[model samples]
Target: MTDLMETLIENREMVQPNHANMLESAHGGNVMKWMDEVGAMSAMRFSGETCVTARVNQMNFERPISVGDTAYITAYVYDAGESSVRVRLVTEREDLRTREREKTTESYFVYVAIDENNDPTSVPELTVSTDEGDRLRKKALDGERD
Candidate 1:
């Protein structure tokens, strides 16, 4: 079984000019890429297999991160299927000057682990402990739609 909290993963990106749009804020695609990468890592950690993105759902951009700031992306294994894992992703923007942080985007991503032959592979069961883990798992399940 997978320990959901211990299996959670995170990655950070420093917004650069290349990642920004004409408005000087990070491009949506760049942010999505970061989210996808971290979510994939979480899926890989849980399944112990290479994971590929199957779907990205309802990514809402609530704010923006400008160049020179840091964008923190977090992913956690909140739910699972026989072969697929659902990750809840959150992107936060950190201001370098005042050290403030705010949520910038959120989405749920689904990934399927594959064996060496690139076929779908089985994954371990997930276990949620603590209130935060349970709360997050419940929220992800509630927000998921097929």
Candidate 2:
């Protein structure tokens, strides 16, 4: 079993010129790529095997991260199946100077664990051992209900 909290991952990236669009905000593609990478990491942590993204559910970019701001991305395994894990991913825009942060994106990513032969493999059951883990799982479920 894998504790849901143990699989939680957080990453931060500075929005630079190369990562921004013409409007000087972080590009949607760049954000998605980062989310995918972090989501995969969370899934792998939960599954204890290599994982590949199978689906991305309802990615919403609520706001843009302007250049010079920090993109804080968080991912956690909220659910699991025989071979698949569901990860909740969220991104926030943080101002380095003011330390203000605002939610900028949210999404759910599904990943399937794979063995050395690249075949789908079973994953350990997800366990929620902490209040924070329960809260995260509930939030992910609530978002799915919406």
Candidate 3:
């Protein structure tokens, strides 16, 4: 089994003009792309194989992330099935100068591990070993109710 916290990963992207929408905020697609990328990374870390996106839960854009702000994406593997990994993704808008941050988006993604021939492969179970891992797992479980 793999420690759930060990699968955690974080990424940051600067919201440039090219990534912005007509409203001058980061585009929804761009944010989701980032989340998917990070979520795949976490899934791979847990599965130790090539992982492909299988499903994405409903995504909510809580707030707009303006251009020039930093987009912070955090992902972690919270559960695993025979060939699938469940990831929780959280996105926050960070003010570069002030260092302030606010939740901008959140979603859950499922990835299926694939073998060399591109067929589904089994993945180890995920384990929560520490207090932080327990808390994160609980939070992810609770977030689903919202």
Question: How well does candidate 2 score on lDDT at residue 28?
Answer: 98
Candidate 3 per-residue lDDT over residues 1-146, each given as its tens digit: 89998999999999999999999999999999999999999999999999999999779999999999999999999888899998999999999899999999999899999999999999998999999999999888888667
Q: How many Å off is the CA of 78 in candidate 2?
A: 0.2
Distance from true position, residue 7, model 2, in Å? 0.6
CA-lDDT, candidates in order:
0.90, 0.96, 0.94
Those runs of model 2 whose alpha carbons end farther than 4 Å from true positions after fitting are none
What RMSD does each model have against the real structure? 1.6, 0.6, 0.8
Kindly list the per-residue Cα lDDT of model 2 for residues 97-140, writing each as its tens digit: 99999999999999999999999999999999999899999999
Check candidate 2 and list the clashing pairs.
none
How many clashing pairs per prediction, in order? 0, 0, 0
Pick out the ten consecutive residues of candidate 3 with the lowest summed lDDT: 137-146
lDDT of prediction 2 = 0.96
In the range 1-146, model 1's lDDT, one tens digit per residue, is 88888768877899999999999999999999999999999999888889999998778999999999999888899988999999999999987778788999999999998988999999999998789889878877886752
Report RMSD for candidate 3.
0.8
Error of 1 at 78 (Å): 0.4
TM-score of each: 0.93, 0.98, 0.98
Q: What is the model-wide C-alpha lDDT for candidate 3?
A: 0.94
